[model samples]
Target chain A: MPRPNLAPPDAAPLREALRGIRFLLRRGGATVADTLTLDALPDPAAGLAKRMIREVEGLARSVDEAASAAAKGVLGGHDNPAEKLDEIVGHSSAAAEFGRAIYTALDAVLRRIGVDDAFISEMSARAVFAAWRQDHPHGQPQDWAADLTLRLLAARVIRGAVPAGSGSIGRVEPVAVFAVLLWLQSDRSESENEAVLEAAADIALARATEIAATIGSGDQGRIAALYRKYVDHV
Target chain B: MSKVRLTPDGLPPTNEPLRVAVRRLRWFKAAFLKHAEEMGAELGSRFEVDDTKLAAAFTRWLDAIELQRPADKSQRRAFFEFAAALMMRELTVDMPLKAVGEPSRAQTGSAAAFWPEGYCCTLFCLSVHAAATAQEFHADTTIDPAIDDLRHWWSFKENTIRDASFSAGFLQMLLGSQPNWVMPDVFRAKPRG
Candidate 1:
């Protein structure tokens, strides 16, 4: 894909967001699921979200049975089962409402550091093209992954806006916050004075990139590089 | 067009520009149930949710997890596949649903008891989304924040499902009923290699 021209001022935050996919590959999901921060929510807020999180297992079961009955109805030539499936899958305004609540909390984290959720694509296209450009200065099909992987490794050493202790890292799937922290770390060589953070980021970003290749696709080559340079080395 | 309007005048259409209000699986389930129950309360239990609309919505949300973020198509597919894996939580392995006509009518069961139904909802949403959009569903889409309603909207879902009709409507179907699908003669296959 062709990328839009973007410089560090506009591209810095966008560049920082490059690690979100790495979260999908890690065990970060369980952390997000378990960390709802329900008490932190305002009163009379997020009832469905509470119920959904509190009783995730039950809701999954109910949704399962419902899907079966609906399938049976259609196969049996029954009239209403399809409607049932339809409702569960699509038309729940209440679900959208409360889902928005949970979404807002996670979104705030991204916005806090100036990463606009809407423009992740622009950032990625730039990364992909940049990856392509590094190997092919003349520029064509080449070792794009190697260049991209090097970039990812470099990203880990830079400082970012997300505080590692935000625990908000647990709020999102696969830990986008983890990726943000990974891509934007304190320059280890420079911040070696902050002993704890350097060690913490090393382990965290390493783990963050550990399964990023497995969980993420297309960039597996580069992600493999991420794993080798970070996790395997650690 | 159908007789009764499944949604109100101002609501978004199933094919509205792609948007995923939340990416987390737990949130997805809650949001889905909340929407279904609210319709039961306000639209009347007899009201039928438009399947295309429903499928389109879920499809947008799920697929966007991959589609909107990845610059390359392969990563996009991989991202969504990972998202799907997350959905397959510790669901009961054995879905010993009775024969289609005589499905076992119990709500409280394990993934063995419920996954078939859950899979049906997810697969159907994916299909409908792909069919209508020719698998180009993610183009020009966005996963914008759905924060406006967090503080107060959930109350409606809680309160709405209280009515007998609402209580017995979609929620009941999920817990105890089964639906089926028959292939149409001329169906659009999603453009996959």
Candidate 2:
């Protein structure tokens, strides 16, 4: 018999592992938390864990600030004390004009992605945004461009379970999903096809759980078992 | 499904370290300025400023970081992104628009509605992706590596917009029986009972 290609789930980067530990500690000292604590391990890779922690902390701060600033910038709000003064003195038009400039830049980006077509819709955009918000409850969940594009495309593609029509930019190839996730990850360098597929699988798992819960499972025992396994592994 | 609203009131009290850090930072800033003015006032007023106060401010800022989560990289990225976005705002606030004409009110409103959350979220997502991906390829990426240089060229953003905070209870409600965390799953060695 052929042996299964069972490799250990690649250990997340040391910093990522440390981040996972810190987050668990912050949440609650559950079984999972106890299972993942960094201090208990006698592993030689201690530095890896420490770096992971630092990396996560650093990323958290950046994401929070960037998300907030980007949100505010495009929202037409005053930038700072100086800008506020400009607004108070009837420079509101100036602020509005500045917003327009940013909008134009954003529009250019959108056009480059070829989402300037009729395949997108506000409802689809809202759905994607809602899904993201649901997942990332604590951190910022706003990505207007991606959200808008995904929804528009998802609606066009997901007309049936088989994904009937072509997506916004035309045919929805598996690689397109990879590209989308890469863009979502803000990575443009190497197209790691495998990683993107993993991400899609993760999404599918989450969506499956939601649908099962809502549809009223006839096999409650099986549902409970599945949820336990998911919560245990994922 | 409908949106779940999270208000600040719903959140638990602020972490003690965070509160201490904020208070200490505020105190350090005030003391530094007073000391500077006192020393400077004697000479050119600015020349006699207290170096001690300046040192204290630096210490306080570091202390704030030390007191924050031991491993919250996203927090740091968010701060930088926030700063970068703010800089970008300053750069473009007085720029000219080349669109055919002014945007419609609805379009403008829609854009405004999307900017704040979208910018912050996107920046956070991007930075995390970059950092995490880089770490995966190399075993030894710096915890606080030369991300700033990348941000400078990549156009990082810092938020200047005011956003409403969700209540702490939001998570509690969502988790009901179990809390959801933005973390990867990892196994910890079990403690002896």
Find the candidate with the highest TM-score and give its number.
Answer: 1
lDDT at position B192, candidate 2: 12
Q: Assess candidate 2 and give its TM-score to the true structure.
A: 0.16
lDDT of 2 by residue, A1-234 (tens): 999999655222332234333333333323333456677656666668757766765666565455435434533232112121122224423322323322232222233334332111223333444463445423111233233234334444222112223423233222233223222332111332232223322322223334234223334343333333222111
**Candidate 2 chain A, which ten residues in sequence have the lowest lDDT sum?**
A79-88
Clashing residue pair totals per candidate (backbone < 3 A): 32, 75
TM-score of chain B of each: 0.25, 0.20
What RMSD does model 1 have? 24.0
Report each candidate's C-alpha RMSD, comma-separated, in the order given.
Answer: 24.0, 30.2
Residues B1-193, candidate 1: write the lDDT tens digits.
Answer: 2111222222222322222323322223333444444433432232233322332333333333434354556655433433332222111122111113211332323221233233233232232223323333443211112212232224323432342122112221221222111211001111223
Docking class of 1: incorrect
RMSD of 2: 30.2
